[model samples]
Target: MKFALVDDIKTEAVKGAKGICPSCGSEMIARCGNFKINHWAHKGRRKCDPWWENETIWHRSWKNNYPIEWQEISLLDEKTGEKHIADIQANDGLVIEFQHSYINPEERFSREKFYKKMVWVVDGTRLKKDYPRFMKGKSDFITTNKPGIFKVDFPDECFPYAWLESSVPVVFDFGKLFESISGISNPMYCLFPKHENYYALIAEINRKTFIKTTLNGEWLSRTEEFLKQSKKTKLNRTFIQPIENTIRRKPSKYVLERGKWKKRRRF
Candidate 1:
């Protein structure tokens, strides 16, 4: 797919606008630009650092192929002065965020202060490598073929998107995420915007057993319990390790049998 921003914001305006900075509500915001990417910048040093670095990374990776629509936002909580500008818009009035680096715990808690439905997408693989590098044998992290999608309903008190700022790594196993949504027939498929095929499989799995198989490229074995077990968690979430010695096989064609030459001679 061709990548470009879906919003009306032009390439030039995407860098900076006169509007107040979403993080601090400062009117000193300005636009910055480069050949490949563009985003807002503060005119002077401000309190909250813009998440431009994080946004740049994702833009470089998928911007040319999958442009994201960035909406200007400045959400505030009446109780605290904390604020957040979500990364993207979810189909059903939900907010979506893509985080790459570690975030402050306080910052995390404040993100979901106002929203009812919010989704946070972080680099699960990076988290695994940072924390659980040495302790491999204990939990036995079973890597699935695809990155798992998780839909965790937050406790009313806890901010749902707050986990994005947790210093501890958050992990997700692809198999586990699929299993969670398998039971619900025709569950909403907006959680993972990157994986379109998964949405179709999820619908099929919910309707009948053994109908839809595999995601990305990994073939799934038939087991309802196993499907349920796959999930993205705060522990060992990462892409599944590829099996090195797996023998590659090709499909074979059947051939018709021929009678011995002796029968033809007798005739």
Candidate 2:
């Protein structure tokens, strides 16, 4: 963990420092070794929370982007007496989890329920195969009326299987920090929760924009608006388009796949 309680104050890990776990109030000893980044370890390294994952440089970078006080917040559920440390619980009550390790679908669902209002910032570059799969799937993206929004026929092809059914928005960060030219060439992509069975909605998100909006508490509202607009788009295409406009038009470009003409739908 990045921060621990020393003298009842949040402090970063330092060699020879002994502190208390902010979440479980257990003894924490700072380990400043050559292998991993300096971090506080629980007594005997017995993890107090099963949900907690080992932190990496990427995780530390994301946590440091927000304010110090917001990083590694301890949250509790009064009803279940459940407690866990959140990576970042924004001032606006939005939890931003920076996930680098794999999480099973059941545990993923449990976290979503715990942090009802949350956003997942997944490390897409963790596995070499991840970004390549997304690039392959990107060629099939169906453009939407909204500039940065797209309709994905098969989201599983582009994103990690764990995130396809996320209750909250999951943003994949495929860029290697300091390696890109502009963010650099890799911008984050957000896969929205399931909307329609036929396709999934995705948005190209700018990293800076996401951080600013989240800090000012606009993230939730903006996400809700996007969800509503997607529903409207589906409704318009299904029922609101004029009958003449829906008629099949002369095909300028067509491809046959599995006995169906791709791109045959009226735009």
Candidate 3:
């Protein structure tokens, strides 16, 4: 993790410094290597939390965006007395998790349930094909009357399926911030899951705007306004065509089999 308790005080890892794990209170050693970012590690190479993953440069960069106190906070469950360290616990009780690796749906759901109000900042650049796959799925979005909100038919195939049914909001970090076809700047795509529909809210703001709006719980309101404006204005169709590729593909094998069975039973 980025910070450890040194003499009961949260401290960043420095060469030759010793610390303690914030969660388990175990002895931790600072690892300052040339290849990797400086970070604290358990002395015996053991992990206190099963959910903890090795910190990467990407993870560190995200943590650096917030204050040091907000990073790696230990949260307690009032009823169960269980504790888990959050990636970032904002002042408003919002947990921002920087996810680099893929975890099962169960774990993802468990984290969300424990945090209650949380958001995921997933690394879209983790895999080479992630962007292409996401773009393919985005192409099939069903426009909604709610402006920035949208309804996706097969989100399981288009999104990181683990977050498809997430109870809270999720923002996908597509590596770089650029101007969209609509002439709006965006740093990430926000996916808000409601019942059976996955609504994709394109963020028309830069990275700082995203951070600030999210912390203040104003992103949803901004999204609505952006969508309203989008409806009134005309976007560049040529630029939209790339991301809106319209080659309708066949359904999955399971879907095909289910359709066939339904047809046979009807006859």
TM-score of each: 0.39, 0.84, 0.78
Best by TM-score: 2
Candidate 1 off by > 4 Å: 1-37, 47-54, 59-72, 78-83, 125-128, 131-267
Candidate 1 vs candidate 3, lDDT winner: 3
Pairs in clash, predicted candidate 3: none
lDDT of 3 at 97: 88
Off by over 4 Å in 2: 176-186, 235-267
Q: Model 1 Cα displacement at 87 (Å)?
A: 1.4
State the lDDT of candidate 1 residue by residue for 1-267, as single tens digits: 011122333223343345444455454434454553444445565545344343555534423322244333445556776555555433344454555666775655455444544544444334444224212211222334443333221111112133423322222212222223225532222222121211111111231221122111111223223334432223233653422333323221211123101111222
Cand. 3 TM to true fold: 0.78
> What lDDT would each prediction earn against the true structure?
0.34, 0.79, 0.69
TM-score of 2: 0.84
**Residue range 1-267, candidate 2, lDDT tens digits:** 888899999999999999999998899999899999999999895897889999999999888789999999999999999988899998889999999999998999999999999999999888889888887666666655555667755566678767777888999898643332123244688888855546677788778888889889999999988787666657233322221223333332333344222444556
Ranking by lDDT: 2, 3, 1
